[model samples]
Target: MVNAPSGISGEASLEDRIARKARELGFVACGIASAAEDPVRAERLEQWLGEGHHGSMEWMETRLAHRRSPQGLWAAARSVIALGMSYAPAHDPFALEEVGDHARISVYAQGKDYHDVVKKRLKALARWLVAEQPGAQVKVFVDTAPVMEKPLGEAAGIGWQGKHTNLVSREHGSWLFLGAIYTTLDLAPAEPHRDSCGSCRACLDVCPTDAFPAPYRLDARRCISYLTIEHKGPVPEDLRAGLGNRIYGCDDCLAVCPWNKFASRAAAMQDFLPRPELVAPRLAELLALDDAGFRALFSGSPIKRIGRDRFVRNCLYAAGNSGDAALVGPCEALADDPDPVVADAARWALERLTSAP
Candidate 1:
């Protein structure tokens, strides 16, 4: 166990002590939030879901009750400790835009799976909390459960939910990986971060598919990140061109946020540094990934969960948009893919590439 700093042992409150310990444990940001229900947050979620903005993510609907509040998930959880780990990229997220032969990957998915990385640290923090105060029960979550992590993150002062419907920190911008610890102990809540996006339309304007219906409201159906990674079939034909070179996830909105100017690239952990091959992978190469090949390539990556077919489907979409005739051979090979969805995408890419002058 790492000991506290020399003079900080005399701190007045336990929350302060715990927060200091959280910093020591590698959390870039840490704050407290109550377990009580937040009516506004709940109503907003209900509205988002009611509007079908969540697209095909049915789990949000099924877990509505438990997700509305921390107490709803665990009655004994008196306070929630929100933590953020920075994965801010050290390089430009838009570097591959003109490089048509290559594919663009979201910064978040270009390295080790964040679910595993964040959860491990969350568990370690939870264990430390338990050991510090014997019998203290804690539950840690990192996007796995029904928990509404974004709103809770905002309430905990980690950052406010921006117009892109993603958390944006004044310090770290849109580069945080959030996690939470629900504990039986009642801790003083931090002041909630107010919406700082005032008059800023950068994120909204940068979205190629116009995913945002309005400021702070996203229609996931049109989001490239949702389409490439979550939508399970051939993408909507109308939106295919907008996907461009983004083969896995989209970063346009996040990359354009003015707040990102404040983010420090050096603060990013080594675990999230983009792998050399994944940094700017050739679209043709990605279009050739077989199931086993895809599995090996993305072995510890979040992209693997979407499977080879979906991945290739995305690469094909990029190929069609690439305007690079060299990808035609690879696109032709997958026109009869076993997965009907991948086959459909291949046929579509052939039409685009062949039709172009």
Candidate 2:
């Protein structure tokens, strides 16, 4: 037999019950936070956007108000359940840094799209909660909406958003996939996660592009993850070399956190297992992909979201940085690609390779 809260009906503590259910659903971390105003987060968001740090992701600016408060986004949402799934790698994500001729994809993109994986589980958890709490309203969200997941995650005790501006879990490390469940059931909130980053500057100093304008803040325009996946046009010439062989997203910051020591010893999820081909793909092979080839190769993967043009555009930059004379042939082949951005990247890559000593 279970006991209910003073007004809500449930046998177990709402927070405990939901957290256990979330773990059963494969989430490594779960906590709840009130769906109320977060003035400091709102102000930080406004300042970040006001400085034009979001780059071409104009949606962030448009959805500013919605992101400030969960209740504002959904008028009836009284509590928020923040969740995190570990995509922790079995080995060091930085180990491939010396592999000049191979494209190093972000560790998170090495497997199935996390958005699909996380959202499916979030929906399952939300459905269970709704069924358990009669007359309660609920909404689920992953990275797709205006939800300020990181701050909410912090408030909910999932983890603190570290110097890299990505959530860091003492137990799960920096490689986490976050999701949220908003409800009107008045669930109990958890103790907020403490800021454990301390004096560690490893994540900040490791950035090849120096993307951080300050501790705990990011300028997305200078972020390689943003440039490869979100920016539509040519990459800035100055930053191209800094990208190294990172063809999709950069994980330099996330990979360097000291908390990752705990993650390597933790259970690794099969859903995040790297596809053999994606582990360290040859730059030459990536550059050879046509649209059809690109789609088929990255199907059911997050890399597909960037589409062929952007994916290949990233490949071109890696090719230029590769310094492998053999890739010049493939680079030249894409110089006349149908997409202007791809063509520009190809020309730039060819120039770099041709001018190599």
Candidate 3:
């Protein structure tokens, strides 16, 4: 454990102590940024929202001011500590797509819910800070918050936000899960990192739905991650065909990044290991899961948040794209699901199956 400098007591400098503690807590990288104006990002976010690119994630619009600048959220906040953990998978995520009958869950969703894992660690770090300096105030945030974590992570030097709009680190590649700790104490800010993705259009070219309108700008409406996780009702018919076998979030952008070749495998956190059934689940079997079965199977996983209806809806699409007539039965069975969205997707899948020669 790294200790504060002699004679400093609670007034010890934050740089060395915090970095050492973050490493001990298993964070791959930690960086600090003073809460300040981000004019460029503010303009970009406003433009993205004006174009209605966020789809049904209305919350993005609700916290526009705070999302663009952290100081807007907490006036007392002096420093934003951005932390990242590696969630790299042992196998290539793209490989699962080749198995026509199986559903492909994004690498991030294959393990335990990252919200829980990252939050626990963030809270621990926050508590440590407060313990070291009595009366210190702090707040922690994961993806649930309205904060623009990607830009903050970038500003903090943890990584650069890639063209796909997710933060990418050279050390961890694009496989990092980000969390933030906002503290009232002033901390030495780290130098922001420069973008290393020069001339690399791999992520842009690989997106099936063409979500990127330009480098670093994403139209989430067309993003599979938004379709499967955020968009509530029927997925736009035009995008369904491009969804391929993905039943949760899409990883084409992240998977195709050349930086990922250097990504480390899953950390020692066993909670991140793929659940036996989730690794390459049969689309037919997944579509057959009832509400109770779905809840039971995804009890500890991030997929549970989508619930059975949306999950089955996603499975229905994958089933349709499987090109295997064997999945027809499950699709047909789900055509009358109690949830209108699920039933509607099932109908669409059935049509695709029947229409196929």
| Top-scoring candidate (lDDT) | 1
lDDT of 3 by residue, 1-357 (tens): 122253366554666778778888888888888777689889989999999998889989988878878888888888899999888888878887777799899988988999999899999999999998888899999999877788888888888988888999887889888899999887778777788899888999999999999999999999999999988899989999999999999888998888887777855356678787888999888988998999999998888988899989999998888888998898989878889999999899889999999
Candidate 1: minimum summed lDDT over ten consecutive residues — where?
1-10
Comparing 1 and 3 on TM-score, the stronger one: 1
Ranking by TM-score: 1, 2, 3
lDDT of 2 at 234: 93
Query: TM-score winner among the candidates?
Result: 1
Candidate 2 wrongly placed segments (more than 4 Å): 1-11, 264-266
Ranking by lDDT: 1, 2, 3
Candidate 1 vs candidate 2: the TM-score winner is 1
Residue pairs with clashing backbones, model 3? none
Residue-level lDDT tens digits of model 2 in 99-184:
88988999899999999998999999999988888888889999999999999999998899999999999888898899999999
Overall lDDT per candidate, in order of appearance: 0.90, 0.88, 0.86
- Each candidate's TM vs. the true structure? 0.96, 0.96, 0.95
Kindly list the per-residue Cα lDDT of model 1 for residues 86-182, writing each as its tens digit: 9999889998898999999999999999999889889988998899889899999999898888899899888999989898899999999999999
